[model samples]
Target chain A: MGELRRYFDDIELGEEYESPGRTVTEADIVIFAGLSGDYNVLHTDAEIMKQSIFGERIAHGLLGLAIQAGLFTRATQAYATLAFVGLRWKFKGPIKIGDTIRLRAKVIGKKETPKPDRGLVTVQRSVLNQRGEVVQEGETDLMIERRPRP
Target chain B: MTGSYFEDVPLEHVEETPGLTITSAHVAIYLGLTRELAADGGAVPDVLPLCFTTGLGWRVPKPPLVVLAFMGLDWQVLRSVRVGDTIMSRSRVVTKRPMRDAGVVVEEREVVDQRGEVVQRGRFTYLVAKRTKETRA
Candidate 1:
């Protein structure tokens, strides 16, 4: 429906993709706090956060990671993904409300397994805010299904 | 209760949270908010468990640290989580490096299913504020 599936064989190192942007919202932070049980005053108490170093409430670092995953999935909707294996992520900066964030990802590494069914692909991802500053960056390893025989 | 100050936190400290069952509703809400569809067989999405680590950390009986900022994360996913799986977290402080006014604490955290099998594990680093006279009172 979106595009033909991009199997493991179809991928190449150095390939790059940019995802659509989504703005962070107040409700997003509030709901995440409730669901995650992270009622840190930095997120819940605006008056208190007004005096903190950041000077205002900020989105959870993990929230930005979760959104990046969704954005990447939507960008390459036809990826033949099997599972997410691991990641090394850094929270470089704060994500404030109403900041439109986009994901820029590049294929950095690939490896084949003993079996021919699937392979691993490593992607370097940067979550960039509206001003073009990278707020979060990471490398994620994914297992992708190989192209099926006809 | 107040959060754990940098100077007061002890190394090798450990804590665990109660089990939380992953329901369809929880999964749906997460997917809906992220604008993603449900996974095959209603399996939980990959990042959901990672997000749950924060909640699980909060649920532990021990007081949380006075985190000024989240520094980084190194995560590994070993098993898949499904809608019916009940998960818990076990976290241990692995390292502590004190700075001028703040300290960095690294926690080795693992998420386990009802059977106590490790579903995922990772090290989370946070920047915590130092305990001061103002904070003491």
Candidate 2:
């Protein structure tokens, strides 16, 4: 009953994290593609994907970003936040269905904004494959409400 | 792309559409590759964070499974998923409105587990480009 109490104070900038990785399936890719309407052949068709440099159907890169959202906001109770200032993404490798992945995040910086009611938080997010290779990366800027302002 | 404009979307729209199904392996692989960023060496592997993956699975065309943000999202937990389960996802146009810059395609997604039980549902929206004037059909 005590695993969920860490906060911004518990972390440091540039620190890297690694989570228990899991595998992906082709069905997963199609569902995501079908649901999102992203018909990118690289993620849907194995034969077509095989022709790509990656040689297999890869999971949607957004999976990494969604992982960050799922982890960060809940762990820190950050969702009560005001606004997400920005986000950036990087796809390092192809994530084939059935390929396991580890979700991770690191605090790159934190700052108190000029507004008395809010502050700024920045994080570096990433996803790695079972091979320990980093596949996806991202950066986030969030506005944290700290107090009431006139 | 559905090319839904940023005007208005209705619930019936998604209801008319079909949901999608995926696998636990894919969910896990996405997290495995993403774990490198979580600082805990990773994010939630069991329950909490998972809702997001389940949620993302339904949302479609997100930033990157590895590094993007929800942009704007809303997810409902109807049930939970397991390792071998097939995750089903469905979405609909919830909102559409014009943007001064790029047009938007707000959407909603619902997810179900292999047992046909709903795992999660979201009342969120997605965006798309009205990049150039699309020809009227």
Candidate 3:
């Protein structure tokens, strides 16, 4: 199981991995709401939702994204990693409760920055639901090692 | 349709001071509201992150897109947000740019607290539906 963890020396650009889908939960939403202080009526208010375009309360896009932490962390936390240089996200549809989200991640590219200790690795991420529809898609620039270390 | 972008939309002003104060009631209310609308169950605590992220999202200078999900979250509870901490938010649109991918655009939302300290920053991309629309907070 731990084989999923890839050290800096292991991964090559263009390498890809797929993970099983996970469901979003109510408890997850509630905790995030309080932590960030975002209370949009559409996200929080049912009545407002009914009066709005969606006609119902939908999962916040970020909730689907946050679930990625569990999926990606499990895959990479064993390896020493650094900062998330940057991420690009796209919201195609609502990720409602009870929906299953599958994570697809791939190492697209790597660049050697001026720093001798670290390099920037670009990884692509996709959150797809049960029907095989992609709800969220993006690429992230993450930190990796410049060379294998003892 | 060919149209102008966020760069063309232009920033009328950057509000540095805290525009609003957040309360526990606000948190609870938002949680309850989202839960009721979503028709999901369990206590409201689970939904706090959703509210906080959205609250922080709106407070972002001009969110090109909303939080769909977060890839990583490292929350520090140095100070528990209380009912009367007078939570204040100062949001600024940090960056905006076009993407190479077909049918998409991206922007960054950076939010700070009352002390002019950063609280949250999110880089999100959205599919543009309108040829042109007024983009503002």
Candidate 4:
């Protein structure tokens, strides 16, 4: 079992965590298409995409969001994450293949849930490309288990 | 396949999609793509990944070939979607605004499980190309 890094009470509001960068690849797009059943030509049809405004295939916006979630898992050792409650996000820019992206997340708010054993932690996240441009930004609310009391 | 032109879409038009069952294989494929390692020895959580929920939006019926670009997505998972649950999706055109050669279409999509419970909902915005009389001819 992975070690629990932080409990609900341990997270400090406004604290930020930066993730290691990973490059988006053609394989990532194809795999995501297969998994999501999103065969949108903009993502799969290079020839057609070249005629579009982007002039080339772009990663699915949701793929970028999913990558950010993966990066958050690696950056913050939140082994106690119970579930993702919700998210409010905007896709600011296109994530082209080969563009390396990373996440900068900060704790924005916290609240106790009706369930005494768990609480909600809201994190504001910004997904930046290698050029430091924000490709996506949003807030995610996560339910986390509280630390066990003696 | 010719997609619906911006002028063709009607506001508040709703479409329902066939039911899709979320199986362990589907979850495994998604988990593999994201590389989200489960801490409990690959035990699938009662709550699915948020992105997966968004992914289901793609399965919803959309205006044919008119999908030009994915502008944005705002979503919320209202309830847990457990593995082996059969879910169906429906979308309604909420708003449409014209741009240069295309227009943006905002759709409110909802995913309901077999039990008739709302599992997820979101607004998906897309840029759909405007069909000209020349193209229609």
Fnat of all models, as shown: 0.63, 0.03, 0.21, 0.53
lDDT of 4 by residue, A28-133 (tens): 9998887766677878989978877788999988888878877887787774777777788888889999999999999999899899898999999999999999
The candidate that achieves the highest lDDT relative to the unseen native structure:
1
Residue A92, model 2, lDDT:
69
Cα lDDT for residue A5, candidate 2: 31
Q: Quote model 2's iRMS.
A: 9.4
What residue runs in model 3 are displaced by over 4 Å at the alpha carbon? A1-5, A75-77, A146-150, B1-10, B17-54, B57-108, B111-137
- Computed on C-alpha atoms, the DockQ of candidate 3 is 0.15
Q: Model 1, B3-91: lDDT tens per residue?
A: 89888888887788888898888888788778665557569987898888788888766777888999999999999999999999988
Q: Give the Å error, residue A116, model 4.
A: 2.6
Q: Which model, 1 or 3, shows the larger DockQ?
A: 1
lDDT, candidate 4, at A7: 84
Clashes of each: 0, 61, 39, 3
What docking grade applies to model 1? medium
Give one digit per residue, the lDDT tens place, for model 3 in A59-100: 766556556644665444444344445566666677766777
In lDDT terms, how accurate is model 2?
A: 0.51
Q: In model 2, which runs have C-alpha deviations exceeding 4 angstroms? A: A1-17, A71-80, A147-150, B1-137
lDDT of 1 by residue, A1-150 (tens): 424778899999999999999999999998888777788777787888888898999999988998898898777755778888999999999999999999999999999999799999999999999999999999999998998878
Tens-digit per-residue lDDT, B20-132, candidate 2: 34444545554544332222222223323233344444244432222111244434344434445555566566555656744445556666555666665555433333433
Which wins on lDDT, candidate 2 or candidate 3?
3
Per-residue error for A13 in candidate 2, Å, reads: 4.8
